[model samples]
Target: MFYHLLFPLSEHYALFNVFKYITFRSAYATVTALLISFIFGGWVIRKLEQMQIGETIDTDGPQHHQKKSGTPTMGGVLVLTAIVIPTLLWADLSNRMVLLALLGTVWMGVIGFIDDYLKVVKKRPKGMIGRFKLVGQVSYGLILGSILYFGGNGDFVAHTSVPFLKDVFINWGWFYIPLVILVVTGTSNAVNLADGLDGLAIGLSSLAFAGYAVIAYLTGHAVFADYLNLLNLPEAGELTVYCAAVVGAGIGFLWFNAHPARIFMGDTGSLALGGALGTVAILVKKEFLLVVIGGMFVAEALSVMAQVTWFKRTGGKRLFRMAPLHHHFELTGWSETQVVVRFWIIGVLLLLLGMSSIKLQ
Candidate 1:
């Protein structure tokens, strides 16, 4: 909004010229989101508490976590607010990339909110049937894919740039829609699985989005794109503001979400954030890098899949001390903080490795 309202006045007033720069807008967006989270974190937690929307710990999981059964959940509302308000205020609302990213975030957020509401408020142990959640995710992918594919010029190709290979792309042809659906749905669930530990998911998400903010800027700049041998996406620079908002929101939420968390993001945050990141990757044509950027999340999701597959294959034999990878370490006598910090170190390494792609190519 500020960009639309103030930037136009740049001709009349030089101060407003700063709004024309994505870097300037992105920096302020980050600060704005951080402030919003700090300002509203307590109130949102209190409101959730007042509504009696506490988390119900799983009995079969970590015995020690049982103590957190009543901690306020659904803090994603604060995260969502921080992200949306900052982007709207700082980003050019007229940008299609910004609008599409917001739609993806809000869409998955609503699905998550429904699930949390069912489990916490409606007293349904099983919140949002699996198929329904899949439907919601698939629907967003379909909409996004259709827009990007059909909305572009006749020469538009449904392809993704391969990492570490200059001018190389995997053209999915018409199958790009399915690819989008897969990326959106898979990423959202992966982040959700990583939410097992305090500050784990949010911390990793913050790092991932921080890296993406840089990537968005590079992809949008023709000079940077040419230097890096990346596809130049006009107007995609606006996504930097959105990605920065996510980073700031995650960091702000982390202040309260650190060990002995004051509130859990629940499905609401995990899904929306994951979806937003995926949407950014799609818009920037860096879908493949998501694997490296979110490597820890992928491991968390894969651990569960592997554990389940092993359990069924071996006639109930267990795989890992527990699933999601984090709990396995916890059950193996690693302290909660150890697991979180180590995972963060690994996430950081992966982030750097992913960022190296900009030059390594």
Candidate 2:
């Protein structure tokens, strides 16, 4: 909004020219989102408390979590607010990539909001039916995939850039849509599963978004993309602002969401953030690198899958003490803080490794 409103005045005012820079806009987007989250975090938490929108901890989990059963949840509303408002304010609204990313985030957020509403507000144990949630995710993925496939120009369509390999791209033809759906849905659920501990998911998410912000900027810049041997999508630069908003919102949310959390983000945050990240990665042609960048989330999702598969195969046996890798560490005598910080350390390592690919190629 600011870009559209002020950049035109650059002809008249020299300062207005600053709005033309994606870096400048992205930096301000981060600041704007941080300020929004900080200013509204307390009010939102209080409102959730007043409305009794508290969490319902599962009895099967760690005993320590039981004490958090009534903490204000669905704070993803604040996160979404922080992300969307800043993106709209700082990003080029006409950019297709930015619009698509925001659409995906808000779409998943709505689905998550419904699930949280049912589970927490209505006291429904099952929340959103599994199939319904999956349907929502799949539908959004289909929409996004179709748009990217149909609207893409020339060689960029239906192809993905391979990391750690110079100028390597795989043309998926019609299969690109399926990959998009899979990535979007899989990432959305993975982040949802990883949201078990306070500050865990958001902490890792901020790191992931920070990494992607750089990737988006580089990918969209012709000179950098050529120098780095990266796939250049000129319009993608605007996504940096959106990614920065997520990073800022994640950090701001962490202020209250750290250990001994005052609030929980619930599915609203997890699913939306995951989906948004997936969308940005796809837009920037960093789909494969997303796995490297968000390896913690991948491992967390895989642990649950492995646990379920092993339990079914062995009739009552288990793989980990608990599903989701973090809970396993928690059950192994690691404090909640220990597990969170260790995972964050691992996340940082993965981020650096992923960043190295930008140059290693």
Q: Model 1, range 1-361, lDDT digits (tens) per residue?
A: 9998999899999999999999999999999999999988988889888988999999989999999998999999889999999999999998999999999999999999999999999989889999999999999999999998899951354878888887788878888989999999999999999998899999999999999999999989999988988788877899999999999999999999999999999999999999998998889988999999899999999999999999999999988989989999999999999999999999999999999987876
Candidate 2 has an lDDT of 0.94
All candidates: CA RMSD in angstroms? 1.0, 0.9
The segments of candidate 1 whose C-alpha lies over 4 angstroms from its true place after superposition are none
Model 1, CA-based lDDT:
0.92
lDDT of each: 0.92, 0.94
- What does candidate 2's lDDT look like per residue over 1-361, in tens digits? 9999999999999999999999999999999999999999999999999999999999999998899999999999999999999999999999999999999999999999999999998899789999999999999999999998888662567778788887788998888999999999999999999899999999999999999999999989999999998878898888999999999999999999998999999999999999998898888888999999999999999999999999999998999999998999999999999999999999999999999999988
Model 1 TM:
0.98
Q: Whose lDDT is greatest here? A: 2
Going through the candidates in the order shown, the clash numbers are 0, 0
Off by over 4 Å in 2: none
Tell me the lDDT of model 2 at 30: 95
